[model samples]
Every structure is written in structure tokens, then in C-alpha cells.
Target: MSPTAAPTLRVERSLLRAGHGLVAGVDEVGRGALAGPVSVGVLVVGPHTPAAPRGLRDSKLLTPAAREALVPALRDWAAAWAVGHAEPAEIDALGITAALRLAGRRALAQLAEPPAAVLLDGSHDWLSDPPGQALPGLGEPVLPCAAPPVTTRVKADTTCAAVAGASVLAKTARDALMARRHEEHPHYGWAANKGYGAPEHLAAVAEHGRCSQHRLSWRLPAAALPPAPRGARAADTLQPPVGPGPGRGARGA
Candidate 1:
């Protein structure tokens, strides 16, 4: 397929034909957000999987309204699904790489049953022997692990129904969390940007400084980032909340 088109479940079907009973399509959201935590979503789909709700595509492709409308149906269509998040403190403490592993582990642990294989979006295996650094176009992973095998593909979220489902779930869950947080910190305008680095969000950070929920390790607005230490390598000094998050406070549609 071309680089710009939406995806299908053909890859999931192929894996099913290979005798995989339950392949979980996994995807992540909010990894690039300037605030809030990262979220991972898992959706299990197999040969007998029900059709995804109509008009469901990559969560990034769908409008907030469309994603909101489809959230319940996606939850019902998957045999099993769950969303896991790594709070900003975890992200600051472990850096994004390990934090992602932590989040993915949490999501997988919530599954009703272990997946036969995990169909992860993107070309890098973020959950396998070799973790994906920046999701570079490294093909499938080769290392073995206690967990089920992982199959990574670029644009899997677009081409695989299971992965797409996971994307929607993660996006929806993360958005809900941001909306909830917005109630407490309306200055960030998270209700509109969902914690992304929108202009208003940057302005708020510049004016109000970072919150407990902001990732201290991530680059923030110019005024928010601490000045580089003199004679220190041009790298970060990494260090390490669920409130207003998805555990239970946020309402899902």
C-alpha cells in the first residue's frame, strides 16, 4: 500500500491463518504530547472477529466526535481490550523507552487471556528483545521473550483492524484523561488539544510553568525548559500521577 492510505485487517487474517488463536493488535497514543502520560491500548481480534464499527480508521485520522461515537462499539467488537498508561512521573524517571514498556506491560496484563502474538503498529518492535528507539524503520524484531511473539509493521494501525482498534481505544482513553485534567487545570487548554503542544498550551506553560503532570524530561516551551548545565553534555538530566487520569475518574462515551 502507499504511505498515505488507510489500512485493513488483511495482515491480521494472514496471522490467523497461521494458527494464531488470539492476536492482539497493540498501539500507543500521547507519546509525543508535551503533558500527561503515554497510553497503550490492546485489542484482540481473530478469524471470527466481529466487524469494526463503521468508519473506524486510525484514531489520528478520526475527528474527536467520530472517535467518541465509535469508542463503545470498538470496545464491544474486540474479544478483549484494555488501555494502560505510564504517568508523567514514570516517564520522567525512566525516560520514554522504559516507560512505554511499563505501560505496554500494564495493558497486556489486563487482557482476559494472553495473546498468541502481538501485532504492534509501526516497523519497530517496541515490546520485544530490541526496543524501538524513535520507531526507526527497523523491520520485525528477532529476539525471543517470555511474552508472545511480536510482529511490527509500519502503518499496521491503518492496515490491521486489531491495531486500528487499539489506536482508537488508546486515543479515546487518553483524551478522556486529558479532559478530566482540564477541569483541574483549565489554563493548559487540554480540553481542546488533549495535552498536545498546541500554541495555547505552550503559552500556558510559559506563563504558569510546568505542572506535576508535565514530563520534566521532555522539552517544554522555551521558558519551561531549564537552561543546559554548563560543561555538561547536551543531554537531559532525567528523573521521574494518575489523578484526572483513566484509572476510574474519566468518563468514556
Candidate 2:
């Protein structure tokens, strides 16, 4: 879709006609952050749902202020909406994919009714549970209801109104959370970077070491500098890998 184009309900309307009374749009945020929780937002729409706000688009395409402004309208537009998060520790224990499922299920659980069908932004069906697969650290099913069938669309966040709204809600919610976390640990610069691989946040990790909020399983910045020389002991280094780090050419915050 063009950058200036607005998302439409065409895709959603199609699903509503496919014998599904309720259709949900699903999206995630903070999956790549060095700290903070991975969040998922679910927005349910039904046959009578209205068009989205005029400027609604993918969260990545909208500015922070624009996204913040759309939240109230988006929330009011949906039949039901909810946001959920999997903390850094959960990410470490269950890994990102499982964490995303956990967060998505949590959001779905908050809805007044389970969606008859789910419309996911990405091409991968990450939200559905594998057959006979047990919940890892969580130990129990996130929802008592049967899992709803999901349909994945690449770039749906940009093409689908409901998906875009979900992205905005998830992004704004996670940003607020990281901003609050920044108040307690000012050095991470989370208020601005939102815990992505921003240079300053990496530098802070390199200097102060990983804190409780950091995903300990992921490679973080080293706590100290390299060894003084051959005669000196080598300083400690972090083990978790930064998926896209400074050396790898950093991605957006």
C-alpha cells in the first residue's frame, strides 16, 4: 500500500461474510527491545463495525504523537479491545515466539467474546498453539475456549484498518510502559529509545551492566572493558545475543 493510503475494512468485511460473526485483528510490539515486555493487542470487529479513523495506518508508519492521538478513537471504534504483555523474564524463559503466544492469548482472554476468526498482520501463524503442545513455563492454557482459526496477511498492518489499530494500541501501550521503566533506570534512555538497540541504551548496558528488567538470556552489553593486556584477567562479557546490534547495523528504536 502507498504511504499516504488509508487502511480499509475490505479484508475484515470479507471475513465477516465467511460465516464468522466476530473477527479480531492481532499485532505485537516490543519483540525486539533489549528491555521491557513484549506486548500484543487484539481488536475485535463485527459485521456492523465502522470505518477506521482518517489517519489510521501501521504503528511504524505513524509518529509517536499521531499514534497516541489515535488510541482513544481506535478503542472506541472496536467492538472490544485489550492489550497484554509478556515480561522480559518471560521472554527469557519461553523465548520470543512462545512469549508472543502468551501475550496474544492474554489479550484474547480479556475480550468479551472469543473472535470467530483472527486476522494477524504477519504471514506467520505465530498465535496458534501447536497440536498437543503444552504451555511452557505458564503451565496451563491461557484461555478455556477453543483456539480460533487465524489468517495471516503480510503487511496487513498497512493494508488492514483493524490490524493497524491493533498495532497502534500495542505500540503506544508498550512505549508508555518503557517510559515508566525509564524513570526507575534513567540511564537506559528508554523514554526516547523504548529499549531498542539505540546506541545510548547499549552504552548504558556496557557501563552499568544488565538490570532486573533486561532479558538475561539475550546477549546484552558487556559490563566492563576488555582485558588490560596478556598478563591481565579478561573482563566479564554478556552472553545473550542482540539480534540486530550495533555491529550488525542497528535497526529503529
Candidate 3:
């Protein structure tokens, strides 16, 4: 597709026509990273116009340059957009699943107008809150009486244009943050790996041990450690059985 060609933006329009005026798409990024925060972005598309760009797809499929290029266009075409994040501490404490929901809730709360309903990328199970438990750091009234229900689906990013837009925003925003972090800790090669547990990253861990930035909970297994050198048995050796006959008789019995 030509750089100038706008990507298709149909998902939100169809919902709008169906009487859902304030439909919003939600997506999160960095769920798999060993470090860094999880970011959730919420976006609402305005009335369909030729000015709206096309070429929407899962953010993973787009390059950094492509995503960067699309960000401004998305902001321009979108009726509204907001991003929320769960910090590394939160991810480490609450886990990725809970972090995702927290980020989503924060993002939605930032929106100027509450959406009639939310289109969350992936399954509804993702948003399952602990029954009657207040959301951490959100204070009392965790589930606002006025908030609308959310809808989620697998591959929602690809099938739903609004979700795709949210993906772009979340991915681009998280990428930028990772890039910034890369400047601070270049030794881990975070810029290239984006905090993923790549082989190089594992090697880095073995060489440097764990850093303050690393999630201590994700330490490499003992097998991942470098192999011991040949003929280097430790002085601590098990003594052989002194009474072999007794052992043999016991075994026979």
C-alpha cells in the first residue's frame, strides 16, 4: 500500500451505525516482557471520513518507523485517545494478567466521555476481577456503578478497526519508552529485544547476573548457567559404602 493511502477504518463506524455512539477500543502491550511496564491504550474513532488513514493491523506486524508514522495520523483521526500504564513494580507484584486489567481501567478512566461499551482485544476472561475485591490502588468503588460492560474477543485487533488503532497507540507508546530505557541500560540490549527473554538476553543475564532492572522472579534456570569445565569435580565427594556385603544381603532379602 502506498504510504499516502489511508488504512481502512471501518470497525468503529459499523458500531456507530448500530447505535453505539460512544464505542471505544482497548488494547495493551508489553505483557510478555521480563522488565518494563504494561501499557493500555483506549481510542474512539470519529465519524468515517476520507481523511482517516487505512492499513490497520496488529502493532506487532508494524515496524517502529511505521508505527511512529501512524501515531500522529491516529491521534488526528481518532475522536479521543488515552493511554495508561502499570509500572514494573506493579507488574512484579500483581502479575501480568492483573496489570493488564489495571492498565485498561486506568486508560478508560482517562477518557473524557465514558464509552457506551468497551471493545477489549482478546477474551473476556482477561478482565475477570476478583469477586467483590476492590482494585488495587483504585480505592473503594472499584467497579463504578456507571461504567458500561466490556466486550472482548480473540484477534480483536485484526478484526476490529478500533482495537487495531488502540494496538498502534499502545505499541508505539511502549516502544518509545523501551527505547528510552535502552539508553539508560544498553548492556542488556533492551532496545533490540524490547525486554523479551531472547537468547542474547539470557546470555547477558548469565554474564552480568541480575540487575536492578531485571524482574528477580524471572531468573534463568540452573541449566541455563554455563556448564562446568571438564575434570573439575568438587572436593566434596560421596564416600563409597564400607559394608558392601551387608548391602548385597539386604538387597537379596
RMSD to native for every prediction? 9.3, 4.2, 11.9
TM-score for candidate 2, residues paired by index: 0.87
Model 2 C-alpha RMSD vs. true structure (Å) is: 4.2
lDDT of 1: 0.76
> What digit string (tens of lDDT, one per residue) describes model 1 on residues 1-253?
6544556678888888999998999999887777888899999987788666788788888898988898889888888999988888877765666566667877887777888989988766666535433322113242112348999987787878889889999999999999999999999999999888788887787778889988765654444445557876644543211112222212111
* Model 2 Cα lDDT, one tens digit per residue, 139-206: 55434233499999988889999898999999999999999999999998999999887888887877
Per-candidate clash tally: 6, 3, 7
Off by over 4 Å in 2: 137-146, 221-241, 244-253
How high is the CA lDDT of each candidate model? 0.76, 0.82, 0.67
What TM-scores do the predictions have?
A: 0.80, 0.87, 0.76
lDDT of 3 by residue, 1-253 (tens): 4333333555566666777768788888877666677788888865553334565666877777888888998888778898878777666666566667777777777788877777777655444476784457744365422335677776777767678788999988887788898898877788888776777776776677666666544435443345556775743233232211221111100
Colliding residue pairs in candidate 1:
7-158, 7-159, 8-159, 92-239, 93-239, 93-240
Better model by lDDT: candidate 1 vs candidate 3 = 1
Residue pair clashes in candidate 3: 6-53, 6-54, 7-53, 7-54, 7-55, 8-54, 8-55
